[model samples]
Target: MKKIQFNLTFFLVVTAAACSNRYQTNNHTAANKADTVQSKYINQPLVSHIYTADPSAHVFNNRIYIYPSHDTATGAPGNEQGDHFDMMDYHVFSMDGVGSKVTDHGVALSLKDIPWAGRQLWAPDAAYANGKYYLYFPAKNKQDIFQIGVAVSDKPEGPFKAAAEPIKNSFSMDPAVFADDDGSHYMYFGGISGGQLQRWDNNVYHADATNKYGEELAVLPRMARLGKDMLSFAEPVKEIKIVDKNGNLFKAKDNDKRFFEAAWVHKYKGRYYFSYSTGDTHNICYAIGDNPYGPFTYQGIILHPVEGWTNHHSIVQFKNKWYLFYHDVQLSGHTHLRNIKVTELTYNADGTIVPIKAMK
Candidate 1:
C-alpha cells in the first residue's frame, strides 16, 4: 500500500508542474499580441485608449510626431522613489496637424529588445539626422543604475533598434535632443532624486548623495553636444546655469522656479528657450539664453500644474504654430498613469511666453 501511494503522489506533482508551465506560456502569448494592437484618436488628452506620458513632440517631414512613455498599470504603489512608474515599452504617435487623426504605432521599443536596460523605460525624445530617426530614452541598466540609451529607425514612427549598450558617460533620466539650425545636435538630460541626478553630484556618482536644500545653488541639468555621428557625446557633459532676471543663480529653496527635470530646448527668434518642470512644485517653467549651452535667465512659467504630481513636456512648431505637448492624470486618476495633451503656445513680442492654464 505504501509503494502504491508514493507512485500516485509523484504523478500528481508532475501534472501540476505541467499545468503551471502551460499557464505561463499562454499569458506570455497574450502579452505579445496586446503589444501590437494599434488604435486611433483625435480629441484632447491625445490618445485615450492607452496611457501615455512625458510627450516629446517634433516635426518630421512636415508632420507632427510624438514619442511618449507608455504608462502601464504596474500595481506598484506610488512614492517619491518613483517605483510606481514601471514602464517597460514605448509607443509613437503622429498626426498631420492639430485636428487630424493620430495613429498609435504600437510597441516601438520594449525592455526585452534592449540588451542593457533592466526596467523603467521613462520619458523619451527623438531627433532626425544621418538619414534616420534617433530615439533617445532613459532606462535603469541591469546593475540598477539609470543611463540614457539610443535607438534608431528608418522612419519617424518606429519599431526602433536599440544600441547594444547605453551612451558612454550618460546618466540619469529624461533625455531631450535639440537639432540646431547650424546642423549641430545637442542632448539635454538629468533629473533630481528618483530620476537619479543627485547621485551624480559634481559628475561623480555617490550612492548616498542627496539634493541640496535652501540657499545652496539649485541642481542643474546636464548637456552634451551630440557627436557628428549623432550616437555619442562630442564633448564632456556640462551643467546648464539658470539665473534669475538679475543674473543670480536660483537658491534651492525657490522650488517654484528651480529646475527639477524634463529638459527641453527650442529656438525662437534666434534665442534658445530652455524649459523644464519644477518637480515637486508641479509647474512647467522656462528660461531664455543667447546660446544652447546657457547661463539661461529664468523667465516664468509656461504651464501651471496639471492634476498629476509630475508634469513633462516638449515645444514644437507645426505648420508655423507653436504647441506644448504635456501630460496629466485625468484619465486613470492615478499619479503614475497619465494622458498626453497639446495646446497652442502664445509668445509675446518680447519673446516671453504667455503662461497658459492647463486644461483638465
Candidate 2:
C-alpha cells in the first residue's frame, strides 16, 4: 500500500508542473500578440485623435517632434481657392521612436492668439534657436492676403506666443525654416494658384495678375535668410530656380516637375537637398545643390501621389536612420481633413534618393 501511494503522489506532482509550464508558454505568446499590435501600424496614421496635415518633422532633444497644421471641418464648401480649409489652430506632436506612442500637445498656437491674423492658419514649421523655439506660419491678414508670421516659445511643445505683427516684408504662404550647420537660418516659401504665388510680381502683390502657365518658366519658390533676431528677413527674398539635367529651368507647363508648395530642406553628406510637393500633380520631388539657395538640379520624385488632392511632407534623420513624414486623406477620405504618417526613406549610393510609394 505504501508503494502505490508514492506512485500516485508522484503522478500528481508531475501533472502540476506540466500545467504550470503550459501557462507560462501561453502567457509569453499573449505578450507577443501585444507587440504585433504595434507592428501593424508601421505605415498607418501616427495619430487618429485629431486631424493633422503638412507634417514638419524634426528631431529636437533626442526625440522626434512633428509640427503639423490642425485641419478642421467647418462645413465650408470646398473650392479650388481652398475656401474649405478652415484650420484655426496648431497642435504639435512628438514620439520617442517609430512604433511608439504619439503625444498631441494640444493648442500650441491658435487663430485668436494671433492678433494680426484674419483666417486660414495654414501649414507651419518650427525651429530651435537663440535658446527659444520659433513657430513660423502663414495666415491671411485683415487685408485678405496671406502673410507669414512668427511665434516664440521656450519649450519645443508649447503654448507659443505670437508676435504683435507679421514678419516685415513677408508675403505669400508656406514658410519653411532651415537651420544650417554654420548657425545660419533660411526661410523658403511661396505657392502657386490659390496659394497666391501667381499674384506676386517682384515681391509685390498684384491682385489682378495671373500665373505664367504656358511656355514660361515655373513660378519660383522664394528663400530668405532669417535675421539674427529670428523674427524678420535679413535680406530680400530670392527666387529658387529649379532646372533640368541640361540646365534648363522647368517651365510652368511642366507640372510634373515644377515646384508648387511645401518646401523642405535637409543636409546629407554635406549636400543641400531641397524637396517640395508638386501640387495638383500630388508628387513630392527633390533637387540637389551645393548651396541652400539652389538652382538645385532636379532629381526625381521622393513620393508618389497619395490618396488625396494634396501632398505635404518633411524629412529628418533620427538615431542614424532617415524617415519621411507626410499626410494623406486616408482617415476621413476628405481632401481638407488629413492624417500624418511616417515611413523609412533610403538613399542610393550615387547620392540620389529612392522613390517611395505613398501609403494608401
Candidate 3:
C-alpha cells in the first residue's frame, strides 16, 4: 500500500492565486484571444485530471454553479470497483460567467458522512427554495435499496447535511427539482427501472406510480409534484414517453421512446421541455409539451453520445444564451471515469432545439 502526501503550502498558494482578481482578469483576457478555444468555442472537460461527471448546472444569485458527481479512481475510498462507476461524494464549481475560470468549492458532501446511506452515491441535483438551498441525491441504503434524499444549506456552495432518512416510501434515483414561477415547487425523479411517478399529496409523499415492479417490462420516464416545502408528494401519476405532434403516446416497445435514466425538465417561452438520456445511454434527447408535467412529443437528440456508457445533463440559460452540461469518458479512457463538458445550445424560432455536438 502507498500513502499519498499533499503539499499544503502549494495548495494554499494555488488557491489564493485562483481567487485573486488579477489572475481572473488575466484569465479573462486570455480567454478573449481569437486563438483561444474558450472564447471562440466551448473548451471542454471543464475540470481536468480528476473525473467529474453528471453535471447539474444551475443559476443562483446571478452566478453559474455546477454540481457534479465526483468520480474516484479505482481502489480509492468508497469505490467498490476498479472498472465501473463507484462514486461516493460530490463537488461544486462556480463561475461568474461562461468562459470564466471556475472556482472549485471543494467537497460539498460525502456519502460516508451521511448517516443513513451506503457508499454508492450516484447522480445529484440542487434547488433553491424557502430561503435555503437543497441538494437532492440518490444512494443505496444499508439494505442496498436505492432511495432519494435531500440535504440543506444556506449557500449554494455548501456544507450540505443529509436528512436523517430519505424521502419516505420513495424508491428511485436521480432527483431533479424545479421551482415554478407560481410559488410552487415540484420534483421529477426516477431512473433505469421505469421511472417512478409521484406527486405532493397534502404536503407529503404518496405512491404516484400505479404499476409496481415486475408488472412492467421496461423503464418509462415518470413525473410528479413537490409540495411548497419541496419534500412531500400528492399521488402517483403516469410514465413520461415519446409522443407525436398530435399528442399520441408511442407504443410500449418503441425503443426510441423507451427511457433509460437521467430525467430533466426546463421551461422556455411557455414550453415545458422534457429531456432524458435515452435507453441507449448515449444521446441526450428531449421532448416538448404544453405543460410542465406533460404528454410531451419527442423532438430530437440534444447531444450525441460520447464514449461513456451513461449520460446525464442539465440545461440552463445564462446571460440569454442556452448551454448544455454533460460528461464524457475521453480523459480517462474508461466509461466509469468520466469528465464534465459543456457546449453552447441553439434553437429554432418554433421552440425546436438545434442538436448539440458534444466536445471531448
Q: What is the per-residue lDDT of model 3 for residues 1-360, given as tens digits with 9 covering 90 to 100?
A: 122225766687788987897788977887676345433234467888578988999999999999888887656442312224568888989999888888899889998888899756878999998999998888878866567888889999997988888876566677787767786666776765322222223224344434323324444565667666766555554455557667665543554554567888888998889888864547788998877777788888888776667788999999999989888776676767888888888899988999876542
Clash count, one per candidate? 0, 0, 13
| Sequence-dependent TM-score of model 1 | 0.87
Evaluate all candidate structures by whole-model CA lDDT and list the values in order: 0.91, 0.92, 0.74
Give the runs in model 1 whose Cα sits over 4 Å from its true position. 1-43
Clashing pairs in 2: none
Candidate 2 Cα RMSD after full superposition onto the native fold (Å): 8.8
Best by TM-score: 2
Q: Estimate, for each residue in 84-175, the C-alpha lDDT of model 1 and write its tens digit.
A: 99999999999999778999988899999999999999999999998999999999998888999999999999999999999999999999
The lDDT, on a scale of 0 to 1, for candidate 3 is 0.74
Per residue, candidate 2 scores C-alpha lDDT tens digits across 1-360 of: 999999999999999999899989989998898567445444788989889999999989999999999899998788887989899999999999977999988899999999999999999999999999999999999988999999999999988999999999898888999999999999999888878988887888899988787798889999999999999999998899899999999998899999999999999999999999999899999999999898899999999998889999999999999999999887788999999999999999999999998642
Residue 192, candidate 3: how far off, in angstroms?
1.3
* CA RMSD of each candidate after superposition: 10.9, 8.8, 11.1
